[model samples]
Target: MDFQNSLAFAKELDANDPLARYRDEFLYPQVNGKDVIYFTGNSLGLQPKRTKKYVDDVMKDWHELAVEGHFYAEKPWWDYHERLATDLAKVVGAKEKEISVMNTLTVNLHLLMVSFYRPEGKRIKILCEEKAFPSDQYMLQSQARFHGLDPNEVLVEVKKRKGEHFWRTEDILDKINEVGEELALVLMGGVNYYNGQVLDMKTITKAGKEVGAFVGWDLAHGVGNIALELHDWDVDFAAWCSYKYMNSGPGNASGIYVHEHYLGKKDIPRFEGWWGTKKETRFLMQPEFDPIETADAWQLSNPPILSIAPYLASLELFDEVGMEALIDKQKRIVAYLEFILGEIDKQVESTFEIITPKDRGCQLSVFLHGEGRSLFDYLMKNGVITDWREPNVIRLAPAPFYCSYTDMYNFGQILKEGILNK
Candidate 1:
């Protein structure tokens, strides 16, 4: 993990990395004449090299099979949605019947809220972290308004007690009990986007369940990037986009999880369409909605095959190297990153802090205590492609699939120079 001493030391660590072969799987960025050290995986993951084939397979089917592609093409478009369910389930730690690949993240969130957030007279409040993704906040607000309740009255955010960098487990559980019968759902990010802090999802879900509230998660930054056990965790539901850590290009399709126990509850309504109907009876052109039980019942339409193709391609790489192994590799690489960044922090005169939790996934958020934007721009000019969040944070992620220790070492050097020079 001692890759911070010099560029040579960093190169040596990269040489010994077991996951080094994965660096060649995706396209790398170039700034000026050299490859830029990209640390923005938490925002947008690099594209897999096999994406073209994945897209082209669908394209080829469209060209030759034309309308017949729905039933006749290779991997038949008719049942194509089901094909991804098994692997997608593996990605999120759910059973095949508990997962479905469809819809964007925000859309899925709203759909899920419609089915789960049925608040009674006074039991209308939702418990979430205050600084949640804006989409989540907006969805909660809109849902509360739609239910004829003011957001201020119904939405309850679990604030950090006093002034703490992160939320406490006891504080959240206490709030859950304080709200008790009033709480409708407990939803939060699996890992926060800005700070890269992996929240205790299993415990939170259990706490929510204990208080008779549904539980869900937004794993936009967590899926494929960290280890999850939604089935084992007994989570009620969850949604996540594939573009971030799943490495499925920009704005890829997302997936959902529903615990298997819920499949038998026919009374629970869903925003449904033909695609979610049972495959055997779907094309029968029937009238009554005999909803296909299981997670696929949540689907509202046919998947955007073009958008989903790259996800399939990206998933293949993960299937080859299972999530456990990937997570193991991430720990090693991120530990290396933390060791280097920590040492660089000591040499600099300017105040710099790693706001991200030490045990987080590969991503780390650096707080420029004094100079923020100017230093960020300086790093960009020096061939480092990390992104700057508003205020004073630069989120760096040395993704396991494509990043090397040398890449992080180079980034630390440029980042240090950027701070010192500024």
Candidate 2:
């Protein structure tokens, strides 16, 4: 595709986007005086205008009701966590009872591991992608050491074939089949932080269960940007943060999922706290911890109501625009980005390569042929904002809710200047 040819095409696409009006909802960053092309929604989403009001409501409740807010406010603070479940369940395509709004991503992962990683004799192994976020790797290592197992022996890291930035679906499935008997848990990120590849969660979940292995997903980058069916897919457990595509502020509350099939079995050993106890019998001063028959059993402490308010605001917008419509819009934006990138690749004859899958979701990872870090800094010196990974990869994500096709074109133009100017 020709560069000018593709740029013209993109201008038209932006003009006709039905979701274009949605851009008015976010707080775009300003550099000097212009709206810089902010495409790093994978790392941190732009804040929604509704978030301020959502947070103010909580502040008002606390100011007026104090402790009584737990019982007396319009939406009782005691029941605040419950208010988020239905919307959380719908976003992940799971039953309401299976989903619960709770702690941060790494915290929930460790909690889930405590229950699911009961290593018996030869069954004590954790399988994960090598390129997983460092926090996840640390959690796995620490969990294995807590059980007195060598991290090297109990943890298996799946690597991609040579010269590949992303893992192959077939390789991942075949590895599970090959080691099905000894694997205890499959923990991985939904969309890799580096390459922006969207893994096939349903297929992997099925393959893991075939071998009796517990499967879990960390959806920090996947939650709001992609469509999932955790219930129908029979995902054993999953956790995600709302700060990325969910448009919640930094360090906002996260969510968890537990298959309904596991509920009602209160005897199932899990690390629990008073917050997870049955609400009806919770304040009876009972010594025993009786968990509610849902994902709520995983909570170890009372939720931060102030933090959760932002998610409620974002989820309502998500409900307004269903996942199908969102995903369709995302595909179009990503395709437009890929088209522009392809045009750049043609002029330079593959001097820059896109590492993420071409047909994938809302993000792309670009690699410079000459000097990656220098080019990265040059782009940053300009009005473009993208994330750079170690050893030469820069990630750009144009979220559907607010990013414009004009932004994608601007990002490409900035990239060209960075390359040619260098």
Task: Assess every candidate by TM-score.
Answer: 0.97, 0.96
Q: Write the per-residue lDDT of candidate 2 for residues 130-241, one digit (tens) a residue.
A: 7689999999999999999999999887898999878888898988887878999998988888888889999989998899999999999888888899999999899998
Candidate 2 accuracy as lDDT? 0.85
C-alpha lDDT values of all predictions: 0.85, 0.85
**Candidate 2 regions off by >4 Å?**
1-8, 348-350
Q: Against the correct fold, how does model 1 do in TM-score?
A: 0.97
lDDT of 1 by residue, 1-422 (tens): 33446778878877877778887888878888887787888888898899999889999999999989998988787678787887888888999999988889999988888788898877789999968999999999999999899999998888875755667778888889999998999988888887888888888899999989999999998898988999999998999998988888787788889898777466786776887778789879898676787788888888888888888888889899889888887998788888877778888977777877664887888777878588888888878888888898888888888888787777778878887777
- For model 2, state the Cα shift of residue 134 in Å: 0.8
Q: Write out the backbone clash pairs for model 1.
A: none
Which 10 consecutive residues of model 2 have the lowest summed lDDT? 1-10
Pairs of residues clashing in candidate 2? none
